[model samples]
Target: MKNYNLRSTDEHLNNLTSWLPNQTVSERLANTGFNIKYFEKLPSVINHCLPLLSALLERYDSRERCFIFNGIKCGFFLEDVYYCTGLPVDGVEVTGVVKSNNDEKEEICRMYLGVSGLLTKGKISLKNLRDRFINAEDTDYYTRAYLLYVIGSFIVPDKTGRSVDVMFLEQLKDIDKTGTFAWGAALLAHLHVELETASESSLAGHSYSLMIWAFLHIPKLLKLLPNTGRKGPDEFPLLVQWTNWLSLDLKNNFHKNLKSKFSDILDNLKDEDIVWQPYKNLQNLPNDHPQHRENFLCRTVLICYNEVVYHRPDLCPKQYGIDKPEYSGVRKEIAIYKKQRKLSGEIDWSKYTSEKGKVDYSKYIQEWKHRSESLLKEALGVEEHSGPTLSSTPSSIGNVRYDCSNTHFEDDEPEVEPLQPPPSEDATPRTQADASPKTPDDGHGSGGEEITWNTFYLAFSGQAHHSTG
Candidate 1:
């Protein structure tokens, strides 16, 4: 594997916690379903498992958009994002162009940041935001500023890593509606884009999600840490499950030890070594947990503003306890259609129909429409294997068992397979959020041409035999 380094946002995230809101504001945030109280307790510095990340990236098939672990298909899913970050999944999509003019932007800055001329070069410094809002008296403005800091520093940070774009102010303007945006989906979309370029040199955009996912799915990694006897509740937004759970070993040789142990686990990986459904027993998930969005998890496009990436949950049917179908990559035509849509000028997604939008994503729409049939087939006593096997692969790590003796995971709950809830009448996996409409002459208009599902299905029926792999 080629040498690669992770540009983690742990330091920024840890420092920003110092500005966490008081109980009143925290409660208010929780009411909005954007609780981030767990962040304040995160360790000052997180020692990421670099060796494991490197190995995973090495096996990442960018074209297929999943990691091929010993020929077994696996990748992060939308469900993983909801479980890991505790962010909402179902709501208005988090995609829109920043249409606020300079006067409007400055007005927002004055109200939230308590400064008139803070928008320097179209961005605000993290330090400036912290110093201004850390001790502000107005609870409303203080909460808004702190949220901006959290998003800029930790959630959707760019490569620069020190500043936040002013565009997010629009979302925070209506705090009550903040939770209405699918923050979890946006985070996953950004991370997917980062992973596509991870092979180059430096990694960015929420690497913690990937790290936690690895440890969760592959239990062997947890054996490297000494048990601290700390256990978080088994619930949604599962990252909270590890709050103050383990301390990082700062010794120089820690990486070397981690690398060695991870290699051993992979070498001896068995058919049952992976945890297909880690959140099977999670209790009392919020009403808006996006369980209905499961069908859209695969064969869909994830949109975070301009970042568009394909999600192929179809590649790993075992994760959902469904039988694996013949492997087929994303269709070339669908890929091209997504690319073309991305290049089209700023979209007025509010006017664009998600189910039957201007773009032709009928292939994905049909697959999602039939997702229930596949699950029903499995539920009817069809034989299902655990997953692909690695028994034929040679290994040098001798006699290692991939077990979870050192961790707090319990095996009491019968791993119940998750089924996609029946689709609603107007249910369509929303790929993007609603934005302000633009004029027809602005190059953003769809020229009054809309592709209905009937037309899309008719066009797609002829190409049904073409492989999507």
Candidate 2:
């Protein structure tokens, strides 16, 4: 590989032009005039490229020159753990089980002002993430997420040989090679940014990415606590059983494959103990246990999830092209449409509003109405130009012409398959999302929808939507 470390910042900046080489991020950011708002709080956004500048100017080595993720060094202070692990805190101690008085709403949002916009008297104020995405425009959050989904598939190869965990695909002997990237984290992160895009002509996905990162990380500063003798086998079996218990959640919220495999990983972990358990002694709790882990796991496992999102970005995945069977099975056009409507638009009804913000929310919004209205749209994954499905006679759901002609350009961030609850009326997958034939706008979705599901979003107003937010 060429020595990226040797280049100067000036040279690298110019080189980046060749890599990204466009104004996609800035253009889309203009859609919501988000640059102004984003800068209002974390003004450093304007100079995001500075880190690269510093690396180049200072002549950092080859490894440093690479875009390293947050988990590399992996250590932090106790105070930082709250945000890192997304635990709750009181003075200096960890307060578990969330401070929400309502039993239904487990706070897990963690980013951007820390409170939920979708609640009233608790009880999953909305339905789930798919609902959030379908109606995101009520809050206007889907702008960037949709774009990144497109870009991630466009730029990176789906099946990469690289992975964050060395053992991720090791046991699947039949599979020779995975992709060169870790897509799981990226998929999760992508869900977050798209949530920001739900608004009409709103902030850029990069801005949302940064915000979610703050929500998940800033407080605890993205620290992963030392493993307290948590075993995989113990936890895996329990997790598998719980996955079945949460079948409605898995089926409704994620893809069919995920739903099928939700219970499919058991045999893999049956022989391993370290792979199952997360804590040393299930009964014996650590005195310093971060409170958020309980709530975070609550939503995913049987435990409640936080209303606030954690920016544990180390878990965030980077871009890779979609060719690998694990993630990609279609082309750009169909991929783009799926992202715009099917993916980010889903609702996350697990949350309801409270003060401490479930799972530790971001200290954002500064106002209730704004957080409930505009900000909610930003988080739900709605978008502009949302309209009646272009036409009915387009043959397959993935064959119609889904247009984003006027959209601001942005690079793909990642794809996130959220953990959600399915619609009571959800129908069987009608058709596969068609891959664009080397054409960027070949509209389609793999197993795309034939009818609009009204997935749900920004239901804080407790009303049906007219169109895309």
Candidate 3:
């Protein structure tokens, strides 16, 4: 087998590091003295990879789960998953059951899990490593968030039918007054994610704590005002008015205080038009505006992500989507928008035009809709409407390595030969001469009268037969 990059998983994952906490197998190997060809059960492999997975979870303040595909580079097949061992990850498999036979593969996964749990609990937190500086709280959040997202990706792809319980996320729902705001933000984001994206099969118990508040309190976070007129989606205050802080006079100090680490969260907020010139005027605000956390500005970022990131992750500023971006690059963009909003005092509303932040939104949704012209033609398979494209080359997609030879039948040139031959006139005359002309067969000879089908049937009568099942 070709050596597919066992690093594919690491690279795909590493691509997201610009935004979130990052730890790669390559980096871990370098740090822990792990030899690429060493035994699968080496101490360094376990010691290095375990806590690394744990630390990535909440590392950069995002909660995205993406696949780290080393399959192509590592020469993996679904069948090989049971044998994950060796390094870089030669031909070993890391999936399937890791517990039953006490297999080496299982042991490794178990070790990784244990390390992750410990890191999330914080005994293994890192301080200032490799010129990259992070505080205790920042370190804890990123590590935990990254691990959970990675674990969740393992549990479900296509974001469906999750079996792993991320109850740990619920543990992060409440932010203590002096520490990480990750708990509350995660809780709220969890609610939005579950409500908007979780598969029905997933219980979403991890987010049970915040779903009510999302329906009740979160719209207020979108605007610079406080919520009024009471509860629920039906009674939701205007998205623009929710954060309007009748107490806007209280200094809009949501993020300026050193105690709150919420600036990271605000920075991660996605905005659509910030890229093109169209919405460039939106973030125009005064550099010293009293509001440190602008609700309307944050909401605009979400709107931008909803437009640019959701439909196509490719369009997102970073591979990881809305939660993270290349930290420095994204922050620069946010700073620009901050300037826009502080100076302009409003976003582009002439186009959307509802009384407040609600635009019926359907008009914007219509922009991306596809036309339905050929669907009927396609269903009928009409060549005029849906003709097949001609290509001389073979497709690589769906190509299987196994042979295409027929497995079911014996090969023989049977179609060209007759099953039975007619007797010649001379032979017929002889059988008739024996008196077969008056009956179905000649009773005397030619072996016809001597043998009976009944005798033949009895010889094979005891052979076994399979039941219909």
Candidate 4:
């Protein structure tokens, strides 16, 4: 537990390079490229190291350390390092620092930026993070989630509106499997919706596309969500069912091709896809490219969704449902996705809107048996029912045949012996003494009494019949 609070510049400099005394700063920079182990260790030294990083960044004539302009932080990129102010303090918020300009500073800047690149989304999107920090063989859900969070931190959209970090949008292209890092991806999606719905500019349209991306990935997201950490048993399943209902509801409200259009947007997003920028708007985006059509499809789908929720007010959950979603950030995401999708169309008043998907609460309940019988059978290596046998006598009850060849000794209950038919009137009745030793008691007259035909039949059925004198 090393103390993270470093007060002075000397202390900061000392803490930053104290690990290796013999090797020069230039030596360390050339050797260390940046990995998870180093990034995890940054927190303890970040407060101290950032000032040195800022000073080093100033050495590059192209880059300058601009922490606050007009009392607000400007989003500045120092080679690969990103610095911002007024957002959640990820590393260090530089207030006051001395500036230095020289070629010698470049080596230190390279070392700091290498680590910083791993943090910032502008430098390392989810795709870059996966390639750099995570090994190709890794597939564990928890590990992917942890990595997504650490990387997602720097994606904080510029609240100052000075510049927009749209590089995070590249994550949409790499989301091949939503279930792998669902919770983390959901959190990131929620952040986008919040920013988009809050805006009144053309950026809102792009934000809508991000929301649709989240919707498209809902299937994998639902499947991967860890069940135990949820607030209630119904929460997780109910979310799935609700998302399912809303997805179809939005599609049915518009034309069925809206579904295909949504899919088209996903399919077209590539590493080279053109995303809108703060400095240069859609003006730079050519009308002929694949990116143009992708953006068009996104807006088209968004317009359709918003129109239905607008006129048909009951379709919005906030107006009617007890479970208001605004608290959890879901309502805003859903509302924006629905709101931005609004387009001009004739209202089909007769279209079905009442069928809300049902949540299987029992499936998520911890105590309930969620594992299928087949799964248990496969695990235990025991067959539930034996294979069919040769034809046998049918039971008197119905068409069910009692196959004697396939006898089951599975259940604990004792088997009953077959009942004998009633004897004819002329046949002599056997006394109890003459009966076999294994014969069960008739529960009527004493053992010495004669066993009558009616008595035998009644006893076999477990019902006694008293004869009239």
Maximum-lDDT candidate: 1
What is model 2's C-alpha RMSD? 24.8
- Candidate 2 per-residue lDDT over residues 1-469, each given as its tens digit: 1111111110010111112212443344334221212112211111112112222112111111111221111111111222211122211110012222322232333121123444333222122322343334422233322222222221111111010110111211111111112122222222232222122221111121121122122222112112212222222112112222222221112222321231222112121211111222233223334322321111110011111122221111111000111212111111111222222121222232222222211121111111111110011111211111110001111111111111111213222333222212244421111111111222221122211101101000000001111
lDDT of each: 0.48, 0.19, 0.19, 0.19
Q: Which residue segments of model 1 deviate by more than 4 Å?
A: 7-11, 99-108, 111-114, 199-201, 226-235, 249-253, 260-264, 287-298, 324-333, 336-469
Off by over 4 Å in 4: 1-123, 134-146, 149-234, 250-469
Model 4 lDDT per residue over 340-423, tens place: 111122212112121231211121121111111111011122121121111111110100000011110111221222222223
User: Each candidate: how many clashes?
Assistant: 4, 122, 55, 10
User: What is candidate 3's lDDT per residue for 246-278, written digit by digit as tens?
Assistant: 213212232222112222222233332122111
Error of 2 at 191 (Å): 5.0
Q: What are the C-alpha RMSDs, in order, of all predicted structures?
A: 15.9, 24.8, 33.4, 36.6
TM-score of each: 0.67, 0.18, 0.17, 0.18
- Number of clashes found in candidate 1: 4
Q: What is candidate 3's TM-score against the reference?
A: 0.17
For model 1, how does the per-residue alpha-carbon lDDT over 43-87 read when each residue is reduced to its tens digit?
A: 554444456666565555544456665545577876666666666
Per-residue lDDT value at 327 in model 4? 19
* Pairs with steric clashes in candidate 1: 83-238, 328-469, 329-468, 329-469
**Candidate maximizing TM-score:** 1
How does candidate 2 score on lDDT?
Answer: 0.19
